[model samples]
Target: MTNEQLQIRVEQISHDFFKKPFIHKAYFNNRLRTTGGRYVLKTHNIEFNPKHYEMYGLDELDGIIKHELCHYHLHIGGRGYKHADADFKNLLRTVGGSRYCRSVKPEPVRTPARYMMLCQNCGMKYMRKRRMDTSKYVCGRCKGPLKLYKMEEANGTQG
Candidate 1:
């Protein structure tokens, strides 16, 4: 939908649920990648992610609007508006708003260990992603001499 539609819907939601008038503008922000909606502190504007509406439909869009409205109303009234604030949480629960604005990003992939340190006396092993000076660090288990070995993952072997 257009920015005008977004503005109208946001205003309606603000009025119906929040019992407050949102004097600021609301728009569809294409640049919003992570959040479904955001309330700008400086401009008092609410920006909605068009992708969220396209993927999740009107119910989700309404929830996003309600969530932002909570921020807008609380901030305008000089009340606690942050996620961790009691006022924000209570108002959000009263209005049945979304707990989170959007989904979280996926966790990054883990890289395999590149180097390992082994103790000469006790045969204790240590794994590391980066190369380190084995001479400087002693084995924790037996305080023995430590030797660094490169991990060979292709053949599933460790030296």
Candidate 2:
């Protein structure tokens, strides 16, 4: 939804749940990466991760809005508003807001091994992402001399 729609929704939820009006702005923040929403302590504004609504739908967005509203209302009322605060926890639980947001992105992919170390004596191989000095290291299994080879070279591929 658009920022204007989000602002209206946040305001409505605030009034419905907290019996308090959210005077500050509430908007979607695309740059928010790890959080569903955040309440700005200084500005009393709430920023939501648009990905939450796009990925999980309105139910999740409502939960996030309620969660942020808990902080907003408590802070505005001069009460404890942090996650660890009892007031915040009670308000959040009362509103049935989500304790935590679900992950919206996948785990990062690991880069392929770029180098390989082979033991001359035991034929054991170890993969590494960086080149190691062969002369300084020995095989763990047989204490044999180790040789480092580029993965592309070992695979017979030209880089």
Candidate 3:
């Protein structure tokens, strides 16, 4: 749906469920890859991942919206709005919001490593399962200093 449509939906849901008005913007954010939705503390705006709605449909989207709305309303009402807080949990449960913003299934892990750290002086490369500390270690070849030259996580795998 369009951003305007989403705004309307969020406002409608807020009034219907929480008996509060959602006075901020609500829209799809393509850059939101992992999170289903997020409520910005600064702007009180809500951003939803369009991919979530495309993949999981309306029910899942609604749950995500409700989850964000819980944060929005609680924060505005001057209550404990963090996920770990009792007030947040209670309101979320009452409204049937998702406990966590659902994560999209990440891309597959490659065989050996998802990132590669390279030496600046010797051009020696080290493939790593996780992010390597460049400051701590040096290259095996020539004992040269290392730098994070190539990050392969974005291309073929999700790290």
Maximum-TM-score candidate: 2
Off by over 4 Å in 1: 28-36, 49-61, 78-86, 153-159
The alpha-carbon deviation from the true structure for residue 99 of candidate 3, after best TM-score superposition, in angstroms, is 0.8
| lDDT (Cα atoms) of all candidates against the true structure | 0.87, 0.92, 0.86
Model 1: which residue pairs collide? none
RMSD for each of the candidates: 3.5, 3.6, 9.5
lDDT, candidate 1, 102-150, per-residue tens: 5635578999898878898998888899999987999898899998878
For model 2 the local lDDT of residue 105 reads: 87
- The lowest-lDDT stretch of 10 consecutive residues in candidate 1 is 150-159
Q: Predictions ranked by TM-score, top down?
A: 2, 1, 3
TM-scores, all candidates, are 0.70, 0.81, 0.67
Clash pairs of candidate 2? none
How do the residues 49-140 of candidate 2 rate in per-residue lDDT, one tens digit apiece? 99989999999999999999998888888999999999999999999999999999878899999999999999899899999999999999
Better of 1 and 2 by TM-score: 2
Task: Name the Cα RMSD for model 1.
Answer: 3.5
Shift in Å, residue 25, candidate 2: 0.9
Model 3, 45-91: lDDT tens digits are: 99999988888888898999999999999999999999999999999
Give the 10-residue window scoring lowest on summed lDDT in candidate 3.
149-158
* Count of backbone clashes, every candidate in sequence: 0, 0, 0
Question: How well does candidate 1 score on lDDT at residue 136?
Answer: 90
